[model samples]
Target: MKNNTPSTAHLKGTRTETAHDGNAKVWLNGKQLNLQASLKYCSKSPTGFNWGYGGSGPAQLAHEVCRQLYGLETANLVFQDFKWRFLVTIEGDTFDLTLELEEFNVGHVMPLIETAEDTDLCETQNGPTGHGETCYFDADQGL
Candidate 1:
């Protein structure tokens, strides 16, 4: 049998690199985000990978992206099939969520994120989500 799926880079570099200056340029909702201003720490477990953030800006972007993609009314993080999924609710009483996975290509593992929008809650405003939280997981953690 021959493989025909497109190559994807997810969680590239050694585990140490994840702890290094890991940055990402995430594109969502028609905008490009440059995150990792305060590169905290990234850990990989059986479930998937989790990264911590510093500055408020990075936190906000991650929060919105996660909520919009996960259809979460509050804030939550889940994992499935070696992929990390974030859930959050937007300001307009709408739900959203984000899913992230590592794409491997030879010697590269890059992250690929996808978002899902349920409804247009553009006018909803109740403040940001997922902040001031430190997450820890096991290296062999699986979902």
Candidate 2:
């Protein structure tokens, strides 16, 4: 049978290169990804986004990427795993990470992230939902 999933080939076009001498940069589909959105969602990482380690900044970065590429709903579902898999794995002082956004999307939707116990995700002023102390999910909600 032929494949029917959306093509991410368009997403493969990336342009994240920046002056490495300064702060680290992340680009998606050939554009710079700013920290403003990330900060608005999660007030952590006042200094800005970072990766190669587990921290608030990485969490924000992961959240932002998932939020932008997929949507806030999916971001809440897959961000923690996204953080561990991509952001935390990026290393070095001057690293430019360009990833296949849809690859994350294809593997991480629906049943995989359908349960709250599976995600350990919570709601906070600076967290996913930007509400309450903890957030829960309705598995039937679907992606």
Point to the candidate with the largest TM-score: 2
On lDDT, the leading prediction is 2
Each model's number of backbone clashes? 29, 3
Clash count, predicted structure 1: 29
True lDDT of residue 117, candidate 2: 44
Give the least accurate 10-residue stretch of model 1, judged by summed lDDT: 105-114
My TM-score estimates for the predictions, one after another, are 0.23, 0.61
* Candidate 1 lDDT for residue 29: 46
lDDT of 2: 0.56
Q: After superposition, how far is residue 132 of candidate 1 from its true place, in Å?
A: 9.7
